[model samples]
Target: MRTVHEVSGLAGVSIRTLQYYDKIGLLRPAGYTDAGYRLYDDTDLERLQQILLFRELEFPLKEIRKIMESPDYDRDRALEQQIALLTLKKEHLENLIELARGIKETGGNTMDFSAFDTSRMEEYAAQAKASWGDTAAYKEFKEKAKDRTSEEERDLGAQMMRIFAEFGRIKDTDPASGEAQALAGKLQAFITEHYYKCTEDILSGLGRMYAAGGDFTENIDGAGGKGTAGFADKAIQIYCSRRGAAANCSMEE
Candidate 1:
């Protein structure tokens, strides 16, 4: 059994956060100690790990609670999806790093924009469907994403690269600055408009994926500096968190 402080310290979250999760029934204690203190056993710890993993994925607390409580929820399947998404995010980040380094070696920006590798989208989609069955949200989001041609997606990619370049020009910029935060808001709107519905939980999760995961962290850092991604992620999080959604989403992926 572990005390709240010990568990929270290990999880890199505050004790208060755990208490709040408990309060919301997102993660309940396994038992109580002699002094009536919460005691977390192995089962609780396991659930906590899953909750933390989803939290890192930017799931609102409520969404995570629903997911955890759902009888059909498959932990391994969801974890695999999170791992794959994080891996893709990491690879993209690495590609940006390579591009930046290449520009440094060369005299100017070599405009070779083949950074995205999309040959596996079909296979991945098939696998996801096989694993998760047919989810309305997943199907809807993917279909929306499919409406764009590969070339259009590339243009969007280029537009984002341009944004990163601007961030590089102002690494020490304040996240709350009109320029930076405004751009952040623009990015949020863009995502919300095109890809998926921008619920409070979805927005927060996507924003956190920009930092909590290593691939996201590396991508944001490689684009500008260590600061830009952190700032953007925080700004987005704050914006989404204030909307009062508690991450109660049930999207397949």
Candidate 2:
């Protein structure tokens, strides 16, 4: 058994953090001394090690806790997975460093630029999970997408852009018109087929994102033409409203 102080020193985790983990039922001590000092045994230390590993992988504390407590939790398998992921991250960083060195040596202008072309969908998915860490929809999407090949995800993304381009071509149509509504239905079905369940509310949120003037807006415009994002957003709003769901795409008719 080890005191919290000893554990903190050996684990390189702060005593305060240990206390917080204990308070949250994330990492509890094995027992307490007669004098009331917390004592952690080997099993507790192993659990703490797992917690740190998950933390290093950028998993939220809640998600980490749920994963550790799940009946299917396998310590060795989890550690192996962590090692592989960290190895990939290390390799990615090394590649970036080498590219930087090459750019520095060559004055950067003659750079091949292919280093930036790496398929990083997994990295982006991790980031998205972190951003929407607690959302059920995000969790469902991640779960469903875990087995998808990078090439498959790329193809699906391309298909979605093509559909957006189709919307762009018909931008001048009335938002509630039959043509626009049919396209909106196709969009909803496409998302539901490839991603999460595209409820009306979710579709409306996506519509708002389409017109929010960032990467999504740029992609829509690039696909369908200028003003396509706004048109799609309005059409989506009309579609959702017609379905009697609350719509967040606030563009005027």
Candidate 3:
């Protein structure tokens, strides 16, 4: 038998967190010593291991409880699935490293820049989930990323691409101008219509991303030539300010 402190130390979890878990009925001591101290046996240790594994995958506590009680639950099968996911992640990372090396060996960042592909960025994100210590938190973040249907994503992608293509032709355009603002309005509505129900917070965050990141910036800029994405960001900031909670993007009430 081991005390809660001993088990928590061994499991690399905080005592307070363990207490919360116990309060939630996620993992409670199976027995108590004569001194009224909590004690864990082998069964409790195994249960804790399962809980940790699920936590590592970023499964919500509600989801984890349901999964644990599922009739299809198989420990060996779950472990096998995790191992396979790890292997894929390793292979993907290796490929990324190879690609980076090739790009460096070739030349600098020109029109032929090798690292511009967007899908590579997506794959890198998937690999990062495994690379980071907490798979669960990453999973949670990813789940909230976007939940539009495949058809909706394709439609938005097509529409945005066309819009950018048109905008790209006008070099010195004022994004805050009425025409640009209208375009931004359409884009925001497109996001609301298709993407995960958006909020001002999410809309604002994405606007910042389009302006700042290499991935989003490049895609937005692809329309106008060099600075189109930045224009879109400015326009969006204004649009979101006007839209706010009415945008229906916020999960918050």
Best by TM-score: 2
- Report the error of model 1 at residue 229, Å: 31
TM-score of 1: 0.44
Give candidate 3's whole-model lDDT: 0.64
lDDT (Cα, 0-100) at 186 in candidate 1? 72
* Reference-based TM-score of each model: 0.44, 0.47, 0.38
Look at candidate 3 and give me any clashing residue pairs: 57-136, 58-136, 168-224, 197-249, 198-249, 198-250, 199-249, 199-250
Selected candidate, larger TM-score, 1 vs 2: 2
lDDT of 3 by residue, 70-166 (tens): 5546677455444433443455567667777776887744334343444433332333223233444334544644575778667768887777666
Across 1-253, the per-residue lDDT of candidate 2 in tens digits comes to: 9999999999999999999999999999999999988899999999999899878867789988877876556677566456645554565677878889988988886556655643332443243233334566766777879999999999999999999888988898887889899999999998887787887867876776566454667878999999998899899989988876433333432
Whole-model Cα lDDT of every candidate shown, in order? 0.66, 0.78, 0.64
Superposed Cα deviation of residue 109, candidate 2 (Å): 58
Top lDDT: which candidate number?
A: 2
Candidate 2 has which clashing residue pairs, if any?
Answer: none
Worst 10-residue lDDT window, candidate 2: 123-132
